[model samples]
Target: MVPLLVILLTLTGAWAGRPVLLPPPHAADLVLPPDQWFTQKLDHNNPGDDRTWQQRYQVNDTFYQPGGPVFLMIGGEGPATAIWVVAGQWIEYAQQYGALCFQLEHRFYGESRPTADMSVENLQYLSSEQALADLASFSAAMTEQYALPEGTKWVAFGGSYPGTLAAWYRLKYPDMVHAAVSTSAPLLAKTDFLEYKQVVKDSIYAKSGEQCYMNVQQAFADAEQLLEHPIGWRSLTSAFQLCAAFDGTSSLDGNNLMQILADRIESVVQYNEDNRAFSGHKDANITIGSVCELMNDESMGVPIERLAALNDLIMTVHEETCVEHRYQSLIDKMTDLDFASENNDATRTWIWQTCTEFGWYQTAEGAEQPFGQHIPLSYYIQQCIDAYGPEYVWIYGGYDQSFVDAAVAATNAKYGGRDLATSRVVLVNGSIDPWHAMGVIVSSDPALPAVYINGTAHCANMYPARAEDSPELVAARQQIGDLIGQWLQED
Candidate 1:
């Protein structure tokens, strides 16, 4: 699955110039009370400096019992609003235990900015460690200010990257966090994340069967060949209806365009159901099953024709109401290849984290990955160089291979990844979630149990209970609630 923050940015229309199709909200519009801002310190380490900024947060006592636990929902690289408090399984759990729901927006995201200027220099303060410090400070102030009963328990909850934060917070502050629910949390930090695409391929194959998978794979091969020849390049561009001009140049642009389309197809499977929150399209009910149907054509056609059908399906699924089919429009829209430009604050912040802390460059190394080797580790490393300047990228938090290697090793050693040793935490993952490759599937110690839900995608069990949900998902969510209940009753 794509990074939680990137998905959220697209949902919030933060792509600036991209004509992305917005998915529906998680549920009915939730009317939250006035938002409150915390005067957070500019730098947590430099407490003596005394410069502060407003950090946005929201609270709901809709189901509060006088002496109940406080549910602190940590936001990812996105805005934290009322939908979190009113429309998720956490809210349902909150109602069950009469817990007070509160969400803390991540620093540098939403209205929680430490500095007005979004220069790379200012974003230095935006790290997971600093974010945890913010949570600790804010939670203390919140408890004291609200006077939420003397011995109220605190539980941490998050999904995806924020899920990693939730689990890490518990590991870091076990005394403060009574329990944590981390769903689809990819704890491992790796430079070459080829496993992500392998999982995507497996998910499609599993859902669509071997024949459909081969057809899709062949379609990618056909497109690759088509980009090599001048005549084929023209035909390929016309077939896909791309807005970008094809000057019959090298296959770099064509490969980039194909990768973008592949990402869209994989994303459809990654967030098939609970996708509304991630995407703003309410009618986006398409899944791998749907795409497979589109790929499997009955009439005999050449490889190029098959490729065209797949591209058409991608556009149909992504933008059913668009006047034209576009993929990272070179002239009018954001190109996937242009991510190196740090013009957008969201992209800049995310890439900085990846370069410095988590080097999760989703690359397709070998033939196993159907997406091709266009978006390799070098592609992302170059992005860091371009965005943060060559000097800074090489010195402080540079994207050098050695620096990234050390960072990933250090992060893995510190966090424990699949071998995470933590207590009072419910680790949940979906079988179809590509990020699940980096998530914990089992634990030798029962204290840190992992739940693997079948036929589910990224954070599938985290959404509000729905009638259409699989029985396994329903049961998995119940198990999480039971675990939290048990933890709350603990000494």
Candidate 2:
């Protein structure tokens, strides 16, 4: 559920020595954003704890008419602010339906921390169950405070992990939430997410052709071999313009270094949008297709030269937040006190969620995967233990492997991850989004339909309508609107 935007910002600020960039234009400087707060228990299960924190939310009744629908835009792992109300897809729908729009920040995210510190004890309260409860509580309190019209239909909207929450909310709280729009939601939770890389490969090949894919594979292979020799490793350092020296330490091994480089490309593909500049690549061509074009440019001649060109392109995108390209910085960011502060944190909280609830580890498993070899699933597992604890059973009630398995089994079963059995829910996914591998691609029933937008990436449909949007994306948004309108009219 960790947003890649958050990951990039955290890494840049902690190790790359840069200030965290501001949110998108629509979300910036919202003129005293009308944010409201609500009180919630630290743990809904432990009612007697009396521990509570103020949860943030914003309600826009500008478009609300008597008995109009209520649109609850659920926030994901990141912060939810007034800008979401101003620019999200739901705002258009709100205007159309004369509906009240609300954006509720997720607990443990944004300014809604239940405790002063993110200690393991305090974070036990953070879970999907508690978050859904927050939505229900907020709804009740809001209705009472504003005296909302009776029998007003409620529709939930979210993208990515928040989208999963939207679907789960509709299923778990049917009476409260009438319909849901979940975009690019990874409903199925798995430990080994090999399919992620496979999708990345598919997206690259589909857009940039087979030669580009082969070039990427060759680049990683070259990196793997280059790191084996001290002289070649030194050459690699200069070729990639690494800020730090590789002292033949295991921490900055070739495989890890290559994966770090590949991650930059992955980010471009994952967040792909037409006309949007990637990572800070001002040129519109700084996208998945252009990345492939750069890598596949055979005119560059040697493998090292081709790699250098690719590295130069990535550097252009990330020049402002450039780091030494060392794995130790990653480890340091995870363990550093300053980096782990509640305000600037994303990794610790997200890693905890993956370690405990869902282990969607993005490992290099398939041959077609772009990342270099030697980066195993164990590497990420070890990271989880380092960040959280060796005692995996601490979160679960008992110390048994069967317990963890059963917990995952129960989660998937309860939420209907792969085969969601909900009505009045429209699931939307981008054809090229890496996370779609873990999402529901087929419609299980007429009441619950799914749409796949070709030539799109993560949560593209949720953004405000842009003139540069592809025809397929434009059609997909219209289809979503039609579905929502249909759901609203349902008795």
Candidate 3:
């Protein structure tokens, strides 16, 4: 899955002069509440470890009334922004129910640091189990601190990985959490997430026509063919605007380049037409339609040339100077343990979680996928080994697929995977969201309702209502609101 913060920042760009039918609340208009800190146990599992850390959080009580339900927006792999407490579909629900709202930053992300630096030993404390425990403790503390009315319902709202936590919170602490809205949450823990790419391919084909899919497939094929020769490699370097010349001999370079290209495409497909308010920016017209237009534009030259132009477009939007395809450069960045280094804390922390807990590695190995099969499953496993050390491999037994398989199996065993049986939880997935493949798109029980929005992308329902939103997304949000309301009315 794409990092939640990255998705927010990348997809939600400046309006770029696009007309807005009804503009959503901007950052300047939002009166963000002051940040609050709560002293939390460093290791809830270990009683012997008396270490404590001040976890960052924010609260918005504007619409709160006596005995109203509490809405907790759980933070995921990224920093928790105070804007979430003030602006979001959850905030609208808060207003309707007079609910008190809160957003807690996950430990080791943003300012909620549990250690001095991101050393491998320190990262051991950053597991999903630990995060769930954090939520439990935080909820109890909030109850006592606020002196909430007895049996006042508590609802959890989250998207992406935090959505997974929101659902699991209700499952793990049924008494503490009354209900949860899990949007685009991947319930399963798999090592080789081949389905991720397959969904990407499917989403492109579904959104764009068959011609667009064929064009993308041909682009990758052309890229791979060019990588076969030295002259072609030089041409690719010039065409793609690589920071360094493409190394044809190094499989690492080729793999990195291909993955970068696939990632750019995935980003567009994942958050296509998602509201820009989530990122606190005006919306840019960066949807699947725009991408397909670029891909199928004969005026932009052949498929490979159009592919290069697409990369350049993303680069311009992100303000990136040049694309870096060096494998060691990524290793160097991830290995940086300095807490002060930009993005070091989050990058390393999330990678550690994947290596130990959820192995949601998106690899392009299947033949049906549009992206080339250059990115092997071993490439990701090696990344885990490289980011951490031999200890990671040793802990799991060996340095092979079996090790990753065992890790993934343990996670799914602990949690019920897609078969997670829970009550008062709404599983929301967009038809175009690649992460939906691993999510609970269909529920076997009525208590565990599933809302599958057609022609939507990742976490589409979580954002504030937009005039441009499809009818399906609007209806999905209404269903989710009604479900939460029903849960609150329960004993």
Q: Sorted on TM-score, highest at the top, how do the candidates line up?
A: 3, 2, 1
* Per-model TM-score versus the true fold: 0.87, 0.87, 0.93
Candidate No. with top TM-score: 3
| Alpha-carbon deviation at 306 in model 1, angstroms | 4.3
Model 1's TM-score against the true structure: 0.87
lDDT per prediction?
Answer: 0.67, 0.67, 0.77
In model 3, the Cα lDDT at residue 124 comes to: 79
Ranking by lDDT: 3, 2, 1
lDDT digits (tens) for residues 261-348 of candidate 1: 5675677667656645432453356778777776777573754576566666656655643223232232222212232334333566
How do the residues 1-491 of candidate 2 rate in per-residue lDDT, one tens digit apiece? 11000000000111110011112333333443588888977777776778778988777768776666667666667666566666555678778877767777788777777777666666677788888888877777777777765664567776777777778888888877778887777888777677888888999988888887888877877777777788877877787777776655574354456666777677777766642332233534568877776776778876557867767776775553343666556556665433236435566666666666666767786666866665666666666556555344475544333433465567798897778777888888988888888887777588888898998987777666777889999999899889877776676
Of models 1 and 2, which has the larger TM-score? 2
Model 3 misplacement above 4 A: 1-25, 277-283, 343-345, 391-399
In order, what is each prediction's RMSD in angstroms?
A: 5.9, 5.8, 5.6
Cα deviation of 27 in candidate 1 (Å)? 4.2
- Candidate achieving higher lDDT, 1 or 3: 3
Cα lDDT for residue 151, model 1? 52
